[model samples]
Target: MFEEKRSILEPAGALSLAGAEAYCKYYGLKGANVVAVTSGANMNFDRLRLVTELADVGRRKEAVLATYLPESPGGFNRFCELMGGRSYVKDELLCRFVFPERPGALMKFLDALSPLWNISLFHYRAQGETGANVLVGIQVVDTEMDEFRDRANSLGYVYEVETRNEAFQLLMR
Candidate 1:
């Protein structure tokens, strides 16, 4: 909107238009007349996410979404069955991440991770209201765990290591 109209819109200002667009896309509506009454009151980019959060989830699906799975190939099949869909690792550290629903969040995460460490497990789903809870499994040796933590912390997203989680031990190890 700012690029085309040269006007900055707060989250509330663009909410109606955003919702309308989401509705159109989710239902695959084409060549239809729609109206949106947009209004704003000095909001920030953080809250601007809520505009789409209220958009019946079509737009939200565009963001990074994640979930965990078992390491065995059979776990993949079981997971798929559980979700009614189809679905690795040594010294793999599990971490849950609050991935923002922004455009570059996924790439940002991969850019930080892929080149340096091996990603053993990854699950993503785009249905979060605020963002996706991305669970990433990485092949980080015990000695490198601290350095890995530092790298993760520097990514500007909230994350925590789940190596000691009992469910992870039973499911992955």
Candidate 2:
């Protein structure tokens, strides 16, 4: 509610949107319309902090993370103080692949290329038992793009590179 309307909703109201977001995220939904029925008009000003902090995280403008810290005093403080990670990664390739929804389809796809490249992200879209699509984010150095292409071709699934999709760049980067 805050992200869209700039109004706060009680916890119950937020849950509907949260559930919808989770479902869309989990299913890699694209260009789909969703409806979330929110309830409860009870508002508290204190809850604004959580909305301000987390809304951006959900929108990909900010990051909220959980890390395992040593079970010792000051662990939480140390974790909070640390800001670490690579600024950018240029080798990731995003591809959309469609495969028949069958018993061996997923494992077969995995077997073809999983050993050759580090898969940074994998998402599946369900289409009942008819077929499915996957959006894969695999890391391949420039020098190895041809080899990666060959391996991807050998998988025999219909696929295309979507690394340059503007919406993806804006939303998932």
Candidate 3:
């Protein structure tokens, strides 16, 4: 048991599975030869939940973002167009926004963007804390980046890209 070998200590649930898969991919090892040690017998729902939550990040599949959009017509639509049209794949984007704290803000946002971008995940919380934070996920094509930025700038919204944020790297990739 003390033999010298490279060992990876992974979490007890979904993250462990993702880690094992990442390891095999990194080493070009076939599943037939690699043994992934994951024990589910001692796992609890809470821990499992946490594992599931982090599994995507562990695999670099999701991203957390903080975007600010104007509280006006077509703002959300412009954002969606910038991201890419709806209909996304697994490796798309997971974006979050801090919406304006005002009447018709949410409606204006949704009305302008829905049906165009396939929202994979959405969460809205009004903390009465100056801005409404919203999280969204969409697919984006790399070639249209300049157009995206131009569209975003024209929308008259203060937006911040958080895909490279430290918290995102630590929690969501």
Candidate 4:
């Protein structure tokens, strides 16, 4: 019999730790000490960048989300309200949004949200189409998640919360 009463096997790679943790959480495994073996002598800059990007997500220390907003007055304000009040260093939130590609869209988005939360990170990927992928990190309190949900729901644009997404953990954890 195995020496340990319980065992879990993880893939041997750069992201073994993140993957193992993700697997355990996905399977709802608990009450046992799990060991992970990660093998890598060195990592290149690209690999290092990728691993850093994914570390937070894999550890559930960040959330990835997408939202749609209208090009109308007060639309952006409502979205900011959904994220709760101003950031106070304690409420750090990570957010991503799919923005409609058009004149002043990016500026409007930032102008509205920056005043509410201390955005720690932002990434914009233009697809040369009608919409662009925008990743944002903000500071918000967990207790206000309900308000976040309500704001997103009524913001008049489609939105999705990707906090528990496996792809996020794998690609940017």
Q: For this target, which candidate reaches the highest lDDT against the unseen true structure?
A: 2
Per-residue C-alpha lDDT of model 3 across residues 20-121, encoded as one tens digit per residue: 678888888884565555555565556554554464565576665789999999999899889865443554555567777877876665554554455566
Whole-model lDDT, model 2: 0.79
- Looking at model 1, which ten-residue stretch has the lowest summed lDDT? 52-61
Give candidate 4 regions above 4 Å deviation.
Answer: 1-91, 147-157
Candidate closer to the true structure by TM-score (higher is better), 1 or 4: 1
User: Candidate 2, residue 39: CA error in Å?
Assistant: 26
The models' CA-based lDDT, in order, is: 0.76, 0.79, 0.59, 0.61
Residue 57's C-alpha lDDT in candidate 2?
79
RMSD of each candidate?
Answer: 9.4, 14.4, 18.3, 19.1
lDDT of 1 by residue, 29-125 (tens): 9999999886666766666555445443544545556788877769877876787441245677788888999999989998887787998789875
How big is the positional error of residue 162 in model 1, measured in Å on the Cα after superposition?
Answer: 0.9
In candidate 2, what are the lDDT values of residues 5-64, reduced to their tens digit? 766767768898889988999999978999998864665555654655566677797787
Of candidates 4 and 1, the better by lDDT: 1
Going through the candidates in order, what is the number of backbone clashes in each? 9, 0, 1, 8
Evaluated at residue 136, the lDDT of candidate 2 is 86
The candidate that wins on TM-score is: 1
lDDT of model 1, residue 34:
96
